[model samples]
Target: MRALHPLDFLFLSLEKRQQPMHVGGLFLFQIPKDAAKTFIQDLVADIRLSKSIPVPPFNNKLNGLFWDNDPEFDLEHHFRHIALPHPGRIRELLTYISQEHSSLLDRAKPLWTCHLIEGIEGNRFAMYFKIHHSMIDGVAGMRLLEKSFSQDPQHQGITAPWCVANKRTKRLTDPEAPISKFKKFTNTLQSQLKATPTVLAELGCALKDKKNHHPDYVSSFQAPSSILNQRVSASRRFAAQSFELARLRSIAQHFNVTINDVVLAICSGALREYLLSQNALPKKPMIAMVPTSVRQDDSDVSNRITMILANLGTHLADPLARLSTIRRSVINAKQRFQRMSSDQILSYSACVYSPAGFNIVSGLMPKRQAFNLVISNLPGPKESLYWNGARLDAIYPASIVLDGQALNITMTSYAGKLEVGLTACRNAVPKMQNLLGHLEDEIVCFEQLMTTCNQDSINTMQHTQPS
Candidate 1:
């Protein structure tokens, strides 16, 4: 059995009926033209009878404080094929996802499942792959997911995520020798010791900056309570939409910011409008815990992510003003992270979040808010990808929401488009789907504002020029 990391164990320990600690993606694909009706059936058969054993993480089941390989790993239990109800629309498919995502993964088996769903209005089928948070973080998951497909449209054979060879050796499943265990212990000890100074320095700086009330200093726990911070129920509502990557890139170029900065600004505007509609907008700016992957190796084993807090600037009414505030907060956080090694960043994040994790797991302060929510942007396949000759359409990430944090916004860039996914407690966030419209509205607002700014600049230059 492999020992579980403290961060991995937190995911398992925090699992509850209301909050199932898992993350997944919704992948849509267009079936090959003039394909027979048995396309989906054939694909399912091929996957089920592929005779491939599940790889690491997929085959790893939860043991006491370690992960043990399930000798009786069942492929059928982890893979399912379903057809949408009559009239087969995206809404029905999303409803199925929202329902399935609410339930907890069975601990007795490998903590993962892949559902091959068909019956959409178009000639499209979707695969929903979900795995427990303990097994993998978003970055590793995205890499593994991308590996399941081929970039060539004519590539044959179905490569299920479980069938993708991760190149892990047998030692991963075998018992560790005593000397190996000792070496691992010593290595872990040394890493933690080395990271101590960095953690302490960061804490000192954070304290000094907080005392001075620095504009860019965002406290880990400095989020205001609002409707989004309310206790969430088990029921979830998922909504996803895609926007042209070029649209956001144009805005970033005009504003001298990054695509991620533009994304956060768009989310900020949408969230601001959402709060106002509910008449529950907080007076102070809301905070978002943006997760950053620190994985240094290609071997996908366990979670390797650290988070930085960003001020959403939801309190600001002006879109440009909100964008500026968010950009400053994000830039400061990035600079701080740049100064730390991966181990140091992980250690620092662990230290800062340990108390809040305890409170969440113990339910001591049910109403306590730790940042408003999570906004994760994961990189996806840049070029168009295909699976068994089907063209991949979009990849939407569905993430977790805890008791006080009822909403999560996760997006990924794929095929020249930015696919945005929103997961929220159905009850806590009334009409959560409305955020999609709001997101579109924010995109248009940015484009118009940039155009106006450019035109004004051109007019000013023309007037200043001598006749």
Candidate 2:
């Protein structure tokens, strides 16, 4: 039996009746008129073939003090099909999926679940998949998609990604097998002996660099307690909103910031407004927990996860200055990460950002609190992707909001659009929908500023032009 990694074990240990720790997404697809069944069948076949998929090395749990191994792999136990009631609308479908995602995954099985949802309105289909945060992170999940799908639409008859029959070999009882067993034992010993130095070096370097490492602005410690900070119930509520990528790009270009910067700025502004409306704004700037991938190599599917405690300059009234401050904070945080080893960065992040409350309740800690809230931005495919013939309409990622931090905001950029999914405890974020409106308003406000700046420049050029 493989053991769970310390980080993965942490996720498992933190899960309680009220808090089910898993991250997932709700993807909407428009079924092709001619071949919906064929496409879905092919997709299912692919999933079937991809059974017994290996968890990433970093995500695997330590079996003991000495070794780490993959979690048990189970396919039928993880993937399921659910038929929505007839005349199902988006609201009904989302409500169902949200409730499903809120509960804990069965620990007896592998740490992931995929629900193939059908019978939704208007030739559309939805797929809801959730994996324990310990099993696969946001970046790793996207990489899995890349492996399962093709860039070409005509790609067909590909074997399922994980269907491995007869994964286990029959044991032989011959006396000669003892020699082979001894050799295997020797090889394992040799491998561990080689790995020990590297592991020790990483541990020493991580401890030395602990103070200097940070993940992102939002992942920091200064985040104050808001309505979103509370005890969460097992029940989850999900809400999603989509914005055109071009519009955000235009705003970012005008301000000379990145698309991610603009997205975060808009979220900051919206949160600021929302808190003010409730008369519950924090006196100091609130912090956000942001996860950034440290995987720099193309061949690696899993990346190291680190967080930066971003100061979401929500206290700043001027949108432009707030955005600029956020930008600087992010840039500095990223620069600090660039200087450290990936192992050091991940270790530092786990120490600083792991939930203290859960650790205490689980009897693993005495007392402490980590950072508040999680805001993640995951890059997705730029070109339109099809599953079978069904065109993927939108992808919304629903992340886990832990007990103390009842709100999780995750965004995925797909096919030139940003789809933001907000998952929160129903009681903690009663005004969740209002946040959506506030986000839209902030985006428009930025767009208007850009328009005014452009107009001013054009008029100035006209006045200075020679006849």
Candidate 3:
């Protein structure tokens, strides 16, 4: 039994009835052509028989100072099979998942499950994989999905996620409480003392950048109030939309920015439209809390991330202008982030993210907001992936919604497309699906902007030419 890292422990600390701290995904898979009606049944049977073992983080429970395990862990209690009701459409499937995502996970067992869903349309099946955020972050979660699956469609006899994972020799079985609390506290205090200088230097660099009026890094509590900054409810409403990776890449190439920058700009435009329709659009550009992964060698199964507050540029009306502003802001933040190691950055984030704890407990919209919302871009497999003869169509992430931030926008790139998943508090953000339409409109808005900009450049060149 190992001790939970301070960052990983905070997720569990923040967990409550209204806000369940879990990161999940909705996977759509196409069954094999030769598959019989019992395909789903066969899959479920295999999982039920598979032996579940305690993996890192998953095995952890509330120990005295650390997380330990239960002597009696049940596998069946964690895995289940369910089918959609009449009219098994994607929309209906999402509704079921929305309800599934709202409830709290049973802490008595492992904090994860795989619901093998049948009766989906298009001769396909769906799987709703929900795991507590304490166990993994988005990047690690993607790796777990890839590890549990196979590259070959015909690859068979794969065990359930709970049963098997990437083989690691000599699991950490250090009898629980091998280390004393006093020693652990001493080690933590020493590390903080060493990290303080790097943290201060990084802060100095950011301050220097901001003094130049170059918008070095966005500070927390600078967000303008909006509906999205309210305390979230238990009910969640998820909506999704996708665009070809080729198109987004093309736009990125044209604008000379990274794919991630383009994605953030698109979200910024959608949020602008969303809030404007509600007559609550903020006067200043809102803040988007973007998570940056800090994984080194992937030895741990828990979170290794430091978040950056990015300006979403909701204040900019022009799509191209918004993209440019976001590009500069992200670039500046990335420069500062590059100078710090993973541990030093984590220390900095802990200091910065601590302020949001107030809202998490009391659900009171702070006089000053930490950030408006969360936007994450998680990369997926470029090649086609399959699981036991079923073609993996897409993987859309359904991530965590915090107390003050009611909305979360996470996207994953699969094959040649970027599937954007939007999760929000059902009551706080009504008709959340409208954001899908707004996203589509934003993509089109950028395309038109790009074309018009190119034409104007050409006309100016022609007019100024020496004939």
Give the best candidate by lDDT: 1
- TM-score against native, each model: 0.94, 0.77, 0.92
TM-score: which is higher, 2 or 3? 3
Clashes of each: 0, 28, 0
Error of 2 at 307 (Å): 0.5
Tens-place lDDT per residue, model 1, 1-467, is 66788789889989999999999999999999967889999898889888777778788898777787899998978999999998889999899999999989999999999999999878999999899999989888878877889899888886678867755534465555544555666788998998999889987887887888889778766899889887789999899999999999998888777889889989999999988999999999999999998888776779899888888899988887787777778777777788899999888888877887887777787667668989999988899999989999999999999988999999999999999999999999999999999999999999998867665553442233111
* Superposed model 2: Cα runs more than 4 Å off: 1-5, 36-74, 158-220, 298-303, 350-370, 453-467
- The lDDT of each candidate is 0.86, 0.68, 0.80
Task: Give per-residue CA lDDT, model 3, range 93-131, as digits (tens).
Answer: 999889999989987666887789999989989889898
> How close is each model in CA RMSD to the real structure?
4.3, 7.7, 4.3
Model 2 TM-score, all chains together: 0.77
Of 1 and 3, the candidate ahead on TM-score is: 1
Question: In angstroms, how far off is 258's CA in candidate 3?
Answer: 0.3
List candidate 1 stretches off by more than 4 Å. Answer: 168-183, 454-467
